[model samples]
Target: MADPTRAARPPGPARSALHRLRGVARRATDHPRVAALTCRLAPRSVRTRTTLAACASVAVVLLVASAAVVLLVRANLERSAEADAREQAEVVARLATEGRLNALLPLDHGTDFVQVVDAGGRVVAASQNLAGRPAPTRDGDSAHDLLRGGDHQSVTTITAATPTGPVTVHVGASMRTADAAEDVTTAALAVLGGVLVPTVGALTWRATGRALRPVEAIRAEVAAIGDRDLHRRVPDPRSDDEIARLAGTMNAMLARLEAAGTRQRRFIADASHELRSPLAVLRTQLEVALAHPDPRVRSDLVAGALEDTERLQALAADLLLLARLDSAGRTRPQEPVDLAELVRHTATARGVQPHPVTVHAPAAATVAGNPLWLGRLLTNLLDNAQRHARTAVTVRLDTEPASGAAVLEVTNDGVPIEPDDREKIFERFARLDDARSRDDGGAGLGLPIARDIATLHGGTLTVVDTPGATTFRLRLPATPTPPAGG
Candidate 1:
């Protein structure tokens, strides 16, 4: 006996077949030669793929429609044949019932044969085609039956009660004409399909190529562009479609790339110029000190060299910090820092200066950021203020009541900056003749670095117009303050 569990399980012949087909496909794909051949034959261009897809879809629709038309024609012909047979049979039965049946029954145009039989199933009258043959046996109880012999026939039978006894009539219609018509229709459709499918494919291929012409042009143009030619843009087709949008986006990307490339080149040139100046100074001081014999002069020269070295170190640190900030994927540690406290501490850390620095904090202002970077930003602002201030520098921290943002302002009593120079001053290595001098500007990276740090913390740093003093304002998104005594 078979296992009960196995017998109880549902048959999965279809599922098994599907699994086998998948396995074969996987093996074929894994074979190196098969893979290479597939890749070689596959449509690589979008135009070619679109053409193939359109052709396949049209072909499938035509095939299904053709089949439906052929089937409908065949069915209608069969129905017509059956109706003719039934009518002929009814007429013959009426004649036999009236006892006026002739020795030979007349055949209609569509009817192939007509026969009349008595109650004992004896052929009483017949058409010329069946003069002596016995009546054919009924295949089924249906009024219409298909009889197979030298030719296929649709036969219909009817019985009538006569004066003598019950009489039966049989009539058959030949299917030869209907079958011939069906065959002709099939041939016609096959020929039409042969002509139409290729026409569709050709039209699709041509239309697809035309539609993708602009894309091909764009690709060629982009391919020919070199890194130095990032400013060059692909031609726009000017139509408001996906292809047009694609061209517009590509132009935008090119614009951004050109700007970035310009910035990179400027940064390199400026950094080289800045380093050359200090390096020349250091080399000259070292050389002079090595040549001099007086101890005091040598010591002073060494000290100047040391100062240059320290400046170089600071410049290197600033460059590295800028590099890190420029990286798009860099992550930094963040914690909540009180802006008010940071301002006071940074101001106090500056020690004594020619221009006294004072801090005012009315309330605690908290923000989330890297404390080290924030401190550097504050220090840079204070240094800039002290260098340009005539008498006093002021640092004030407050929170915007309407926007809930932490606002820090560093003000100096100095000559007001020109409106045109305010935005330009934040650029790397930029200096103003009135506001910045080689003797005190200190390389011009401080403000830029400070602005970058502010941006990194999701804030803005700008020079706001203050009546008699130059004010640099920093704004950062504020965090919620803690409860008083929690």
Candidate 2:
């Protein structure tokens, strides 16, 4: 005996991806809660997926911050250099006025050098370290403009009457002060890049993850969820942001998926159970006939085998079609469909009485689709109506020519099904009778198959139930009629 519990249950789809950065190298300085959160989130999506988005956002901020630091340091250095240069120029001006510009010649300090020149654009004095005669100059006559800013390159000179006609006095300092200022700037930049980058980087990552802590908690809780606990949902922190909306949408989707999964699993189990009995009966009949020596018994057993084989075949086909329909979603196609004539022909072929089958179709209600799939879809609907229909099986195809969508509806009067069960009747192998009897012939895949075909044609197959009557409505988008000559 097959274990009843071994029957297959419809499994749920996989979860969304959200875990990449967390799985990377971690810090010991992290908080316990953050560690727990990381562990929860780490095993999810592959690394660097969400990391690039986060890194890109942080990179903009870090680049700006580091640039600001560099700018501030450089600005300070420029200000100090400007003040020093102004002070040095003032000292040299005072010496020239005192007539000591020629006396203080070739002066030098350990790392500093000075040069002074007369007013006549000639090197009057130079730093001791700056060897021999006048310091080299590309333009000796450009003294007027060069003196105002005390040029650092060649010896700086200004014209002044030095008791010996108009002469040029020049003075310069080796780039000690400017170099010191640059050294300070370089040191600051080094610290910012070396120290601040790592520190700020870690903090940025932690802060980002902290801001998204609720999501981490929700993910952990969601991952741990099983069928028994589907009703559990992540509560909304409700600051009205994308994160909150994500939590809300996830909760809603979970509810829908849970309900659908429960229904589907039950349906599959019921189908398996239903299939087992005929198989058992057929096997027993065959065994008994083979054991005995009666031609009649053998013939009867052979007939039983044939009938069971037919049922099995129908069962297998129904199961496969239902699986495809359920998995593909209701996003099928729309093509050339001639419902009025096709409806008449299918009814005639099925031998369903035309008197009961009312066709309210236009002369030609042509729509888009595979004709065979549509035929199968319609036949299933008609066949379904015939089973439980009492007085009539009314079929109608009402087309809205303007919008190019046609509505095909079949109404049946019979054992009044519950409002909810009317939709349930459309599920695979979903005959509600506990004691399997006359309803077993069709394999109960009609409504599901019809629904699939309707969906494939960009339509819906739904049940509108009233007392003693159930209507299966299939609304299919219409196909465009071919255009005439231009």
Candidate 3:
């Protein structure tokens, strides 16, 4: 028994067939050999791939459109033939209703073949061409096909009420003209599509090549550039397109690489020179101490040698710090540091200096950073201030009102740094004639290290202009202070 609650559903044969086809395709793609074959057959060149894709798309569209046109033209021609046949059939039916249809029907030889049959299915009247032939019978009133003289005919039938009884009228029109027209249309479209598809593919190939020409030139130029010739740049098309932007971007990258290479070479040379000075001094002191026999003289020479060794060690340490700072990917643990407290503690730990160091931190200015590096930054700033100050070095810690960033300023009452030399002072191993000297026990890396630390904490350190004094300002993003006792 059928379940009354179940809804009627269609058995979707087309959907099931599509699902099966998809499964077959998936399995074929999954097969290792088939996948390998597909990969091997795939075109590697962008131009070839684009051309083939364009051709395939055009082919599919043309094929579908051609098929639709043929179908539509055939349908229209068949409808026209059927309509003519129906009109002829109605004319015969009207003659039969008036009892005027003759046993031998008149044939115009252009309209259609006509015949009349009685209710007993006997052909009583017919056109002169179909006089001896029997009329065809079908179940419906729609147009149908009949074979005559090796050609198909579109036949339409109708019924008419006569004075004696009900009779049937049949009319037929030849389908040769419609068939010939449909065949010609299909052949023409096929030829046109064949020509058009190849033309489209050729045009696509040319366009793709032209578009990628700049990219190819860039690749060749970059390939030709050697490590020593970083100054050479790729050609720019100067157009406002992606290729032009790519060329510009690549040129900019080359510029950066060239600058970095220059800096690297200079750094190596400077490092070598700086190392040689202390090494030569130490060697000289060691030779003097070894040659002398007097105990006091030997002791003094040994002390001098030891001092040079200390200077070499300090320089080596600074170089190592700079190397670590240059590594962009290195990460350090961080914690919130109170800028005011750090400034005070760093100054106090430095002990006494030639100049009086004053701290003017009145409030808590908190920032997130590695405390060790932050301390070193502050210590370096204080040392620089003391080294250059005439009377006093002032350290001020406060937050910027507008951005709420913690700002630390170290000021010294020294000869103001020249506007031009201000930025140069922060360069590694940079020295000015008045400020930096070999005898001052100062490796010019102190300020640079301080700046690197500030930058590592997402902050900046720079020298700000001040009257009759030099000021080094440090700015860091501020962190919220914790609630009391929390």
Model 2: worst 10 consecutive residues (lDDT sum):
10-19
lDDT of 3: 0.85
- CA-lDDT, candidates in order: 0.86, 0.67, 0.85
- lDDT-superior candidate, 2 or 3: 3
Report the C-alpha displacement of residue 362, candidate 2, in angstroms: 1.5
> Once all C-alphas are superposed, what RMSD does model 1 give against the true structure?
4.9
Predicted candidate 3 versus true structure: per-residue lDDT over 1-486, tens digit per residue: 886544354358866988899999999989999989989998999889999999999999999999999999999998888888787888888988998978987754434577788888788898877778765656743324442545678777799999989998777788888999999999999899989999999999999999999999999999999999999999999699999999999999999999999989988888899999889989998998899899899999999988888899988988988887778444633598887898988888777768788899966877888888899899889988998888999988887798889888999998899999989988877888985578763878899999998888888899999999999999998775679999
Q: Which of the two, 1 or 3, has more TM-score?
A: 3
Q: Candidate 2's error at 452, in angstroms?
A: 2.2
Selected candidate, larger lDDT, 1 vs 2: 1
172: Cα error in model 1, Å = 2.2
Candidate 2 lDDT, 273-347, residue by residue in tens:
768877898898889888979899899888988888788887787777777767767555555667888888887
lDDT by residue (tens digit), candidate 1, 66-86: 899988998998899989989
TM-score of 1: 0.84
